[model samples]
Target: MNYSKIMFMIMIMLTTLMTISSTNWIGMWIGMEMNLMSFIPFINKNKNLKSSRAMMMYFLAQSIGSIIFLFAILMNSFIMTPIMMNEFIKTAMVIGMAIKLGMAPFHSWMPEMMSNINWNEMMVLMTWQKVAPLYTLSNLMNNWSMYILIILSTIVGAIGGLNQTSMRKIMAYSSINHMGWITAMMITQTKWFMYLLIYSITVAMLCYMMNMHNTYFINQVSTMNESMTEKLTYSILMLSIGGMPPFLGFLPKWMAIQSMINTEMMILMTIMIMMSLLTLFYYMRMISSLMLMYSSMNKWMKYKSPNTMMVSLMLTINMSMPIYSIMSFF
Candidate 1:
């Protein structure tokens, strides 16, 4: 099942991981190029005209970002290389990474492409593919810029998701919101690995749940048509996604708040909390849709669960593990 494309993606990640750890912007740019080139064929593996068009659009967008990133690197190059970070160069790099991460104002391609792509492909596209580029962004910033991005991302991500009816678009905006939490935690990258870890575990768990339910379309899981089990799953996932108490998602936001308070970013902390309220609407909409008791037909319907109890048990543990990690700190 397209093993070669999968292998290519792995190589791209490996290459990017190596280059981003290096000292020069040129090396990082090369790594990003490697990643961008490798993903083109992967995105088009199904050979649909739509997939091809999405790939083309992704390529063009990444190309522009790369060129701008490379130009910024070269523009600031000097005969005597400065040991310190350059503001302009860092800002350019920030924009480049934002484009890659599907942050708002630069995130047009992500939702459209995610909607059309297959779930397994979308799984990789949404998750594993983000690691290397984001790690690079973390490397480029100190605690301060990270804090700024955290706030900016929360603002744009929440507001963007507020108006979306499309399921993939909602996830795309959710990705941005997730990025905000991770970026905020980046201020103490070493101390806050817990935040990132919890966030990743939660995201992967949600993806697994989505896959199991065959819920590619949000409408598919609505309370009106889906069985009671699926509806139960929808409620749990919405709580987890919205970082409501007792769910796995709350852990990272908890850590991020602590980190922000320690940094004396009180205003930023307040803004993040406010934005979380905005973000809650879309997730709660999904929940309300799932738990609606009225049925179009008066008969109870049953369908086989797509998972073994073991899988459900494991995901529950994944969510629980992060909670324990958070508790230990307190």
Candidate 2:
């Protein structure tokens, strides 16, 4: 319970929210820098050697991205008209956002960085920390570059996760894969917000479960000897994250696919669906171990109870699926 770190985290969120709500590019950059600086201190709160190294790595990468972003902004400022802005400036902004968002080609830092941080910090890295950069990426006005990133991200995110046994790395790739869909949704311009919201909630749920169980590796998941209720709760959450049917995580993918179809992006939709299935395959692979119940262990396991708070949180997150639809009516 480090209150200073908590305050910094709150500042990060506030600054990012400010960035998104800003209409002026310079004000947005100011807010973005505040967000980055606040996160650096928060991440460095843990004094582990690995954490220190990770903080340095993250700081360097983010600084470089910020510099590039600032250059793009400066270049754009010189333009007298919106139509007068050059492709190079737009592409520069796109590249900067991609780096910050950890999209493919610029994504090497994410998995490595995630492995070095605590799971709770990793949750912020995967979800909340991404909001401003992703919103910026969506507004870059470079559709062609974004399209290329969408293809590259889905391909890289899928292939990269195929051989990983580290839960954090798997989640890193999952984040990238979801980013591809989010970027694609940007083309439709109206649906990316919903996808981002759902993705954030689903990711938060997965991270909370993982942190509660103290699970780090995929193999660790299979070996967890939790009670039936606990096992089933986490398993369902994992399946939902992998975009399986009848789960909250599936809703975003469903909406994304519909958006793609509406835009006649059949190939992109097919690739996203295929990659989603691949992700689910790996989740099922890990879950197979949990599903194999021993008859002798059943009696003892039935009596065990999991954390009440976590169970309540998971239930609330799961209920978001129906709640999302109900809210859509308004």
Candidate 3:
């Protein structure tokens, strides 16, 4: 492992933690700025033009968000009435953080940026980068506005990916879809941290598997003549990612649905379920392509085994919930 890269990532997480733990807006802004700077160095480290473009877009988006946040903080300091100041501040903060979180209307940058980077960077972008902004939004934004954003994100994520063929772009939409669920859970004050934890781990496992197999596009899976075991392994991964029943991925979705129903958000839950089904359609499409090839293969080559660590992590992700549930009785 590269110690310097690991250290930079640690700093990134530390700064996000700093933002979340800060008491004042200025402290939080400073922490977020630190986090942003640390992250810029980590993106597009390969010196390619596409990666550079992605980094630039990410920087501009983040910088614009920071400016808006700081302006809101400054304006709030001068306003005499708490009521007026709170309104302006909340509006500005929500818009700013929405852009940072790549919530829809401000979400186009995400798929474009994801397209330029590799799976590892995409994993970080999808999961860890969401921590501070999302938590901050949960703490500060009004429930009504958050709900609206949640619906918009789910709708956009579902529709936008319908025509996409790239794996990273598909994952980008998937992240947006999951964001809607995450926001809904946060709005309901459900166990959002638990949701985030499982989401991050599942995304990490999927990205790791994708990285190992050098699979970058949906077409690549169907075109590359892979072993039956390889095809089957990835098929299960795709199913798990789509939140099929009995998989670890389904656990969080089930929890969120239960929470939504309990809150009498039946209509919202119905829309979310329908949109989630749209995402699953493409996931199944990808898996079917692989399965079709798997069924026709003539002779299987003896495979190079996966890394022990990779297999262990995959098993842990797939089995962690079931094992925990079993252990609960003891």
Candidate 4:
């Protein structure tokens, strides 16, 4: 909310746009570097030990990725003789983007960093910071290795959060899982942007509610002195985020599934769907704790209702299926 943070946020957005719109690799690299610089301030905005550590880890990971990205670009521009070398450079570029985006195998830092930050910063990290690298990776996703990464990311993401107590870490792993679906979208070259848009909205909603409540862990949810309606609202949002049917979050997955089926990627599609169920299982576990498990409540504690804006947004997202079905009828 401060002027300096606002300025940096604007810079981040502008640089992401620059990277996505750039015609060449060097320009994209510069844009990514600028975005990184703009975001660093947010990482340490709290000036605590955890934030400091997160900032350091984030900086190191991004710096290494940027260096490899730049080196690969230079090699591609200067040494274009052999086909094998060209393929190697391409793979290197993909690896660089993967590290930057926190794809599987390069993803260990994401959950650790996210768990250390506040929800607001984690929202940006989970959503906006991903744009440039994901765009770049989509361009380099023609190889078989990228498919392997898709599988690894989905599997790792689905399983990694099973034991997590921290809500932020759970969201981090969920983002990684969604990244697999998004990356897979690149293969079909279909509605990846739609998927990202719906994902951003869902994540922003969840983070906003968590930050408002100052909720950080799974245990906190069950202990909150909330009304049944409020708990039900939260449960619906969680299910939506897990891509349950009749919610806005499920729309993009439906599109992606249709595209995969059309392309005859049955095996990959089946794996992704199964892994997605694992994600839903954890979400349901959290919801059960939220709605079913009750702690002794203080009689004087007041239950707060969600704001009108949040309520309206929730209604809109939940109604998406019927809206889409009606539209399809026309």
Candidate 5:
């Protein structure tokens, strides 16, 4: 890349380091803010007015929720207790964090924002950045509101993602869906971190591949003629997102649910499994659209390999995570 790109990556790296190092909630929140601001410049690098507008809304939404986070911190401190507090402030703070993370009920901006952002930026948005806020919150409090909020997030994330047509939007929903799964697993932090690590690896690899393929616009892939290899690639990617057994996505969710089931959360597990149908169908839409073989007039008729060394490594990661997790567990 260019100097600008190098500087941007450095900005993100430092922000990530800042997040992991912050000892307190406010410090962590500020680190997240720094990360958010540092990354905004990259969101709409094409300088498209659409990207700009979406970025503005995203920044505003994150900022507003952050204000509440700060406010809750102030109130929690005023209550003459350090981190522990009563239900009202606790719930408010949890909701505020949820909103920042784009969990449902507060998720209106996410799909809209995703529709406009590039996947490289979307990469950072999805993985390392996400783990920070979540880990921070889990470290701060282990309370009932967090559990309820996490469950609600999983429900909204899985269901809300059903009707998406844009690739970014689909991935956005996927991010939210993982957010829910991670949230549910957060109740038992140590075990959930394993889930999170597997999740971040799979998602990062998948989204990176999507970006490299320039699968930025869903219409571009769906409405255009797709080559056999492209179609096969798309099919594999979609199945992975749907959490098929062979793909990486399957491992974390499966592990987390098995953990939940062990604790007798059958109802919640049922809800999560059922809502997954929503994601499954939509993911299949991409597969079906790509499954159409290339015709003379198809856009992807000239398909050359997008397979770099990275794609090979990513594919290996995707195919290997589940098998390893299963073998290690059982």
Candidate 6:
């Protein structure tokens, strides 16, 4: 809300644009470094110890990634390389991006960081902060190592969220899982940008609603003094986020799956599908807690009316499938 925060946000967007638009690795690396600097201040805006810690962790992780990235860029730029050295450079580049993007195996920092930040910060961190690294990674050659990273990311993301009670942590792991899918889109060279756009919108909506209600943990869902309609709406949104059919979130995944099938990536497709089901299970668990569990019946408790804009957004997400189907007929 303050000018300083607004400035940092603009810097974040500008830096991401710079990275994605750059023609060479060095330019992209500079953009990434600026983006990191901008985000650190944004993350620490609250001036609390928790936010400070998260900021430091993010800085350290990104610094390491950027160093590796810079080293690879310099190696590829200056040194005349043989086939083996070229492959080594490529591998280093991928690892650097993976670390920065918090892809699995380098992903422990993400959930830990997200769990410490507020919902708004979490939204930015999960969505916009990922653009530069993901775009960079996508432009790299698709190789065997990428497939291994994809499988590991999907597996770790799905399994990691199963036991998490913190909403932020759950979303963090969900982001990792979705990152796997997005990376697959890159390999297939399908609609990765489209997928990323849809993901950003979905995450923004979910974070908005969660922040509005000040909801953090799964248990809080059951205890909220909300009407049945409101609770049901929230549950539906969660299901949509879990990529349930006929929801907006499912559209991109459906497209990705079709692309994978067309490309004959049967093994990877199967694993992703199974992991998706696992994600859906935990989402359903949260929904069930909201709808089925009995809460304390306190007549004096004040009930906040649901935002009309948020309700409209929810309706749009829920009805996207039907809309798409109707459009396809045209």
* Candidate with maximal lDDT: 6
Evaluate residue 14 in candidate 1 and report its C-alpha lDDT on the 0 to 100 scale. 80
Q: What would the TM-score be for candidate 3 when compared with the true structure?
A: 0.90
lDDT of 3 by residue, 97-193 (tens): 8889888878989999999999899999888899988877776645356777889899999888889989999999999888899988887764888
Per-residue accuracy of model 5 over 1-330 as CA lDDT, tens digit each:
578867876887788688889776677778878877877777767777888987898899889888887888788765644455777777777777788888877888888887777777777777766766776667646667766766677677777767766778888887787777777777744577777777666666667667656776656676544454445555666777677777877877777788887778788778878777777877877666566544554453354565644555555666675568668868
Q: Which residue runs does candidate 5 get wrong by more than 4 Å?
A: 78-83, 217-219, 222-230, 292-310
Q: Could you tell me every candidate's TM-score relative to the true structure?
A: 0.85, 0.92, 0.90, 0.93, 0.86, 0.93
lDDT of 2 by residue, 1-330 (tens): 779987997898899999999886777778889998999887888888989988988987888888998999898896634456688888888888888888988999988888888888988888888889888776776457888899889888888898998888888888888898898888865768888888888888778878888898877876676766677777788788887767788888888888788878998788878887887877787677788755355542455355755765676576567777678789
Error of 1 at 8 (Å): 2.2
Q: How much lDDT does each candidate structure score?
A: 0.71, 0.82, 0.81, 0.85, 0.72, 0.86
The parts of candidate 1 lying over 4 Å away from their true place are 79-83, 142-148, 188-193, 223-230, 294-306, 318-330
Worst 10 residues of 4 by lDDT: 297-306
| Window of ten residues with lowest summed lDDT in model 1 | 297-306
> Which one wins by TM-score: 1 or 3?
3
lDDT of 5: 0.72
Q: What local lDDT does model 1 show for residue 115?
A: 73
RMSD of each: 3.5, 2.4, 2.9, 3.1, 3.4, 3.0
Q: Write the per-residue lDDT of candidate 6 for residues 1-330, one digit (tens) a residue.
A: 499999999999999999999987788899999999999999998878999989989999999999998888788886533234466788888999999989989999999999999999999998999999988887676666788889999999999999999999999999999999999988886579888888898888888878988999998877776655567667777887788888888888988898899899999999999999999988888789777877564342235454755666666666677788678679
Itemize residue pairs with steric clashes in candidate 5: none
Worst 10 residues of 2 by lDDT: 295-304
Better structure of 2 and 4 per TM-score: 4
